[model samples]
Target: MDYGEPTKLVFSLQDPKPVLCMNGDVKVTVEPNGRRKHWDYEVTGSFVQRACAVRSRAGHVVAQIGVKGMLAGKDFYHVVVQPGYDQAFVVGVIAILDNIHGESTRC
Candidate 1:
């Protein structure tokens, strides 16, 4: 099986570092590499209810994900991606968030 290209998850250390939250809330900048030369996207929200939103540099909410329901003790999340945004990328970021917070994607 072929895994896709490398995806990087960068956390800011200063200037615009992410805020700390006991509830597992996170804020991160995505795709800041110099080659593409574009503004980075930001993902922010809480992991408790799987509520998260991705915002563009222009301060628009391009995508958001939240718990839609629970069944058999498992949560179901609903994701909404605005036009011109990458849906897969948004979901990938959420997956990374889940992994980081020891949620659904934990080992």
Candidate 2:
């Protein structure tokens, strides 16, 4: 993902040891596959809470994910995507996070 900067994340199924966690704060750039030229989105929040605010490069918060099931379970979460943002894209980002954190998709 390129937001016109040096920051990016690269992943591959072939990689023996994939990175499961971001180094520090909960910040990342996401670009959908086959859409390298498409606008990349930024996700930023507290690493501890895992509540993320998805924003466009313009700094508008298009979506936000809340830790709803903090007391119930680690697998539960809630996301609110703004009207203009694609719901599928938001959900896809959430799904990627689930995979990275081993949330609901864990075996």
Instruction: Point out where model 1 deviates above 4 Å.
Output: 1-20, 23-39, 105-107
lDDT of 2 by residue, 10-105 (tens): 421111123564433333445335445534456677423667787776889988888666545554567789997788767766676666656664
lDDT digits (tens) for residues 1-107 of candidate 1: 76655565342311222254454324444645545444456665655557767777677998888988888877777889999887777777777766555667422
* Model 2 ranges off by over 4 Å: 1-39, 70-74, 105-107
In candidate 1, what residue range of length 10 has the lowest lDDT sum?
9-18
Question: How good is model 2 by TM-score?
Answer: 0.57
The collision pairs in model 2 are none
Q: Residue 104 in model 1: shift from native, Å?
A: 2.6
Backbone clashes, each candidate: 0, 0
lDDT of each: 0.63, 0.58
- CA shift of 105, model 1, Å: 4.1
